[model samples]
Target: MKKEFRSGCPISSTLDVIGDKWSLLIIRDMLIKHKKTFKEISDSDESIAPSILSARLKLLESYKLISKIKIPKNKKENIYLLTEKGIRLTPIIIEFSLWGDTNMREFNKIKDVKGLNLDKSYIIQSVQDHYNSMLLNF
Candidate 1:
């Protein structure tokens, strides 16, 4: 579906495409946690409803952020992978992690967000590289 922006502002436009309760979480599942199947993503800690998961997956696909493929052996199962566009959001996700680790830890009960001591660039590249490697197996 073509996205309708609320304003011409870049941030607003970006939000139009991804600013939702569930969109980024879906992205996070695929990018950070390597969740590919519908069941895997739905079983996340957030416990997103199946209906909302379906809608967010479609929205992400409509924006070219993810691509879906059927398992070769099991045609009934699907694996959702992030596209280049979606992988580009890795840095943003990393930033959010850092922000939450630093600021929201107390209220959120986050004991620690791993790799806080490591270089941000290294972490980002590692995540993107992992995704790229996964692509080669398909």
Candidate 2:
């Protein structure tokens, strides 16, 4: 169930919906890894618990941020895909990643890390291109 907003502040409202660490990590998995299945999402680097993952998925769906679609070829399997609303979060995710890359010393030292240019328009464009390609394949 969605929580009631405490005030009209935009940030607060946004946080109310997605402030939890796990929620954004789930989004990150979808955006970066293109994971869809429950197993795939829960198997991310962050090692989210199955119960937490299930709850977050429900919340994301309730907020219209993602859609759970059953693959046409498989009756028992469903894949989660970002809605237009969820795709809008790409820029924010890019900014957060850039911040971590820049300020977090440990993150920078990670092996084979390809740094983004920190250009907002370029990042958004790149994400849009990827999203478009995914749509074509879907």
State in Å the error of residue 55, model 1: 0.3
- Model 1 weakest 10-residue run by lDDT: 108-117
Worst 10 residues of 2 by lDDT: 106-115
Model 1 stretches with alpha carbons more than 4 Å out:
none
Clashes of each: 0, 0
Residue pairs with backbone atoms closer than 3 Å in model 1 (clashes): none
Model 2 — TM-score against the truth?
0.90
Report how far residue 131 has shifted in candidate 1, in Å.
1.2
TM per candidate comes to 0.94, 0.90
Write candidate 2's Cα lDDT for 43-136 as tens digits: 9978999999999999999999989988889979889998889988988888877777668867557433464854678877787678758867
Writing each residue's lDDT as its tens digit, candidate 1 over 9-80 gives 999988988889888888988998889999999998889999999988998998899999998899999989
